[model samples]
Target: MAPVPKSMSGILIDAPGGADVLQWKTDLPVPQLQDGEILVRNEFIGINYIDTYFRTGLYKAPFPLVTGKEAGGVVVASSSPEFKEGDRVGYISDHAYAELTALPAAKAVLLPAGITTEQAAASLLQGLTALTFVREAAGIKQELGVSEGPWTLVHAAAGGTGSQLVQILSVMGAKIIGTAGSPEKCELARKNGAQWVIDSRSEDVAARVKEITSGRGVDVIFDGVGKATFDLDLEIIARKGTLIVFGNASGPVDPVNLLRLSPKNIKLMRPVLLSYIVTKEEWRSYATELFDLIAAEKIKIAVFKTYPLSEVRQAHEDLEGRKSTGKLLLKV
Candidate 1:
């Protein structure tokens, strides 16, 4: 094993702003592990939209934060009995833009033999988000009275979390309608298991979805586009359906009028991934199912690009600009 270094390099932001605020430095001190923590030398860092939320001040954090939520790496030091030196793991934790991250043991899972470090980094956060939301948020389960699946709509279907949602919904036998910006992305969404695709930019999304469902509207909608599509979601959701809004790519949704939900008795939810897996048991159960799907080739990971740590600014720009598809990673 390589000896632990006294210092590390990573992107640091002193204040919330735009991509310009992300600064790369080589002299940051290595993080000291607290009890129930493990120190990992990160090989690949997952770049998520939530990272952008923190960078742009939409999601508040203390100044000088090393903003990152997930990474795949090998554990180099452990203060917990559950992990040992050289264990390959993927974890969800803060301060992950760095080459070294001190992770809480409970938020991590040991990488199975068939899963690569890069794959783990790419899929863990988004995959688990899709899995938990479909199971818990939408309640689309065979045992929970959705035996024949539901008519589901996933916005941004070619994007990271969107792709995963499409794939999982397909596995659960849902008839999926996906929306994307372009023809190529629409094709990608189809390949990821969207049975029907809509060109959100040039098409009438509500009309297309209504026609596809034979004027009945979809049973559930997974919308990450926020304000840009929130009203439209209400237009096409079935009575007693669920609307799970999980991101703000086109900006936050304005304050909603609760009276709007009264007509259809629509179930509205705005969920964060962390809230679903607060306990170790919750984390482990979902993570194990996610890895099983990966190993079985039921869920395919699509990495749009892996940027060098220094090019993180460009990466963030591409992500926020909606220029990339699938998962984005940083090579640490």
Candidate 2:
């Protein structure tokens, strides 16, 4: 067993700004486990666009807070017997930027052998987010209705959550149309199983989408790139199509009318991951299926960059600047 330390280190959010303000702080308590909880010595923390929001003050925290949300590690202490010391585990929980954190045993999923800590860190949050959006928010149930054509559209296709959603939708027999900023990213999207990739920066998204489906828009459109993509997403969905607006990467959109919702009879939603995986059973079920996808080699984790924990500021900068093609990580 690794020697347990009395204190842990983490990135501190002092004020919101560019990556310049992120600070490394030591001496956070090596949290003691409560019943049903375990202490993990985190090895890697996932870098996400949301972390940039928290860092730049686009999203506010309680102040002087730790900044990361997902990590993979080995359990060193457990009050729950179901998990033991040295178990390879990873989770999506608040405060994961720290070198050590107390996590609920139930919420921490044991990683399979051959899955690196970096891959585990890369998968948890984004994978679960994708799972919830497709399986719940869009009502993509297993039964294939006769009216259902296996077609879906995803924006920001090379992004962390977007790529996972693309893979999941493809494995479920959906013909995927993915949009990205560059031709390189468009090709990456194709490698991830997107049947068609449109360079949204150069092409008319609605026109290309129409061409792909022979003037019929996709059955579902997953839009996370907010204001920049929302209008186009709305314009491209077929009548009665489901449009899920789950994140605001390009900032929030202006208010629209209820009448706008009626024109196509579109089911527009703003989904948060917590809303779908609200219970322990739901988390386990979704997480298990996600792991199975990984284990079966059906979905791949794309980590484009990694930095030492102290460079979290730079990591956030890379993510928010749209310089990262896939997932980023902070090695603890």
Candidate 3:
């Protein structure tokens, strides 16, 4: 191994506001490890909508905090008995937008053999989110007591997390109807295995869903767009359908009405990934399944763009402008 530095470059959000708050600095220290922790040399970082929230103060974080929540890298130092130096790994953390990171063993997962660092970075946070939504929240099983061709509606179909959900549900033999804002993104959704794609900006989401399902509504809806799409999701859900509200890309939903779901027999939930993986065994199992899907060519991670660490301000601008499709990565 070559000599490693004591510090490296990273992107930081110094205040809540806009793109101006994203600052580039090279003095970020190579994080020190405590017991059961590892020092990693990151190669790639994931850029998602929540990262924008952290940047804009929609989600609170300490000022001057690192801006990424997901990354993949090689472990350079460790005090954990299970991890060794040079082990490839990936994880989601509070602040990971650096060339180096210190992660607790509990928050990290060893990258499966044959999976590239890029794939791991693209998969972990988004893949785990998809798994938690379908398997845990939606209760998607071989038998959910629906018709042979059950439908699942996913908002922001071309996004990192939504793409993963399409892949997962398609593999489970469910018909997936996805909403994207553009024709290009609609094509991307179809290419990623969505059975139907609705241009949410140009089409009536509820009507398109009804047409796709032949006058019946969908079996489940994976809603992350919150205020913009959550109400429409409720309108299109079939009786006893499950509506999983996992994020708020459009903005926070105000005053949820549990009473509205009564007539539809709907199951509404706010699912979180942390709740789904309560133990090391559960994390390993989900990671293993995700890797198996990749290894078997059942899923593909779409890396839409990559920016150098210093250009994260431009990256956030592009993301907020809705110019990005699929996962955006920051290369260290």
Candidate 4:
């Protein structure tokens, strides 16, 4: 292998605030490969709302932390038997924001043929998250009593993760009702397989959902937006319905009492994707299923936009502003 660069460019968050806090430094040292680790030359880095949480301190990170975790790249150097030089791969990690970074071999997954670097970057974290939401968290089996399919409410349905959820649930025969803030975003959700898209700007969500479900509410509500939608979700959930609160894009939800769910005997869950993907076996199963859906064109992983590494601040600006739908990537 060629010699590693003395330094590489990356975005760092020195203190939590707005997009301005993203500190871009060109002379960041190239991470060193360690035993059981592989060095990668990143091609695409995905920008997720979780990155925003870390950036704005909704989720804490050590000071001066790198700003992203999702990226697709090719192995340039390897010290692990499981990975070799020249292997195309993608990874999710706290250290993936750089041009070159070291990752544990166990955390890396080889990019299957026909899956491009951009696609892998965009889908691995978000797609697998959506899959686990429908298959595991939503309890689409006996637990939720909707083995074939259920009426699902996906908030922010045109978003990177939400869009993936809509697509996957669409394939699984679910009746999906998606909520978006704008007409365009609503249309995007509809395009990705949502049967009904509600424009939050113009419609009362509870009323619309009740109208659509004829007051029975949906079988499941996948709510990524927290405080802003929590009450509305509870109101629109069906008897014994499941409500999966996955992300806090708008803001953290307020404290809740277990008694709050007694009205309908609703099932409330807070699932973390990181927990589900921690084991290599679980990661592989979800990732394989995600790629298979993509390969068969059953799911479309949307790359809404891309920015050069230098423009990472603008990327963050757009993401935090909710200006882009689907996946946003930084071309590294």
Best by lDDT: 1
Give the Å error, residue 244, model 1. Answer: 0.4
State how far residue 51 of model 3 sits from its true place (Å). 1.0
Tens digit per residue, CA lDDT, model 2, 174-275: 778999999899999999988889999999889999998998888899988988887887788999999888777999767877688788898888888877
For candidate 4, the TM-score is 0.96
lDDT of 1 by residue, 70-126 (tens): 999999999999999999999998999999999889988999899888998999999
Writing each residue's lDDT as its tens digit, candidate 3 over 1-118 gives 6667887888766678888877788887777779998888889988888888878788777887887888899988889998989999988776788888888887788887789888
Worst 10 residues of 3 by lDDT: 141-150
Candidates, ranked, lDDT: 1, 4, 3, 2
lDDT of each: 0.93, 0.84, 0.84, 0.88
Give residue 90's error in model 4 in angstroms.
1.0
Per-residue CA lDDT of model 4 for 1-332, tens digit only, reads 67778899988778898888887789998887789999999999988888888888888778888868889999999999988889999887767778898988888889899899899899988898888888889865323322247889999999999999998887777889999999999999999988889998899999999999899999999999999999998899999999999999888899999999999999999998888888989887778888888999989888989999878889888987899999999898
Alpha-carbon RMSD to native, per candidate: 1.5, 2.2, 2.0, 2.1
TM-score of each: 0.98, 0.94, 0.95, 0.96
- Backbone clash tally (model 4): 0
Clashing residue pairs in candidate 1, if any? Answer: none
Spell out the clash pairs found in candidate 2.
none
Q: Which stretches of candidate 1 lie over 4 Å from their true place?
A: 142-147
